[model samples]
Target chain A: AQSVTQLDSQVPVFEEAPVELRCNYSSSVSVYLFWYVQYPNQGLQLLLKYLSGSTLVKGINGFEAEFNKSQTSFHLRKPSVHISDTAEYFCAVSVSGTYKYIFGTGTRLKVLA
Target chain B: GAGVSQSPRYKVAKRGQDVALRCDPISGHVSLFWYQQALGQGPEFLTYFQNEAQLDKSGLPSDRFFAERPEGSVSTLKIQRTQQEDSAVYLCASSFLAGAGELFFGEGSRLTVL
Candidate 1:
């Protein structure tokens, strides 16, 4: 079984400030990790994913995440965040060649202007 | 449609009543998925379908929850004898196939069971 854990339940940052949302996972086999963002009343949109090579993966809207295999972590980060970045972020993990995706509770990012 | 479309964006049902939510996946999509999101929580996988065949339903919470993708394009999730705990947002997602590809999600159908 595969599981995802997002450490922070909420994070607040001023506009143009850097932000990082921590995520960790436990999987027996090789895994695929992803980050997704959800607006107030909209569905979730993919932020980025880590499949194979390149520990660092850049995503839409200037967000990025680094996959640390040894630490079992895939933390999402953004150098500078805007007010529009305020939303709910989720971390998910899926085993290779499997259709099941396990998601963490979620982290609410609030960018204050 | 350019994206996955879910119908009845909002539904309110009394306890013990049944409700059905619909989802229309993007054209040419081969895989469809259903998830349930409770308040302030991430979406939890409920079921999955490959074309018209239901391949995975291990995440379903109970037997009262039923989902079917009759024609491989459109899908329906039906909840019988709904309870207060069943209130949540039902989200539908689709992808070309289960791989490294990203999944496209619908706006979701919010169900409020009183």
Candidate 2:
């Protein structure tokens, strides 16, 4: 079975500051990793995905994540954030042959002004 | 539609009442998925459909939860004898390809069981 763990339940950072949300996963087979963002009263939007090539993946809204196989981590990072960037971030893993995804609990990002 | 859309954005149902949620996937999308998101939690997979075929449904929590995508474009998830534990936001997503691709999600249908 595959599982995902988000080290932090909540992340607070001052405006214009850098932030990182930690995510780790455990799976027996090859997997595809993804980060999604959800604003208040909205569905999740794909931030970035790592299918093949490019361990460092860039996503919308100036967000990026690096897939570190050795560490089993895919941490999302932003050099700077805005108040609008506050949202719930999720890390998900989908195994090679499976059509479903296993998601971590989630990390609430609070971009303080 | 331009994106995945779900109907009845807000639904309040009695504990024992049955509820049906609908999802309209993006045009030409071949894969559709259902997920449940509890407050302060990430979305959990409920089922998957490749066109009219339900390729996977192992994520469904119980027999009370039923989903179908008969025509492949529109999908419906029906919950019978709903319980308070079932109160959560049900999200619908669609993708152009299967196995590996980004999914487009709808705002979701928030079901509140009382």
lDDT (10s digit) by residue, model 2, range B47-97: 999999998998899999999998989999999999999999999999997
Query: Which 10-residue span in candidate 2 chain A carries the lowest summed lDDT?
Result: A94-103
Q: Where does model 2 sit among the CAPRI classes?
A: medium
Query: TM-scores, in order shown?
Result: 0.98, 0.97
Error of 2 at B99 (Å): 2.3
The CA lDDT at A84 in model 2 is: 95
Cα deviation of B103 in candidate 1 (Å)? Answer: 1.1
Residue pairs clashing, model 1: none
Q: Which ten residues in a row are the worst by lDDT in model 1 chain B?
A: B95-104
- Model 1 is docked with a DockQ of 0.77
The superposed Cα distance between candidate 2 and the true structure at residue B72, in angstroms, equals: 0.8
Q: Show model 1 residue runs off by greater than 4 Å.
A: none
CAPRI classification of candidate 1: medium
For each prediction in turn, the share of the native Cα contacts (below 8 Å between chains A and B) that it retains comes to 0.63, 0.71
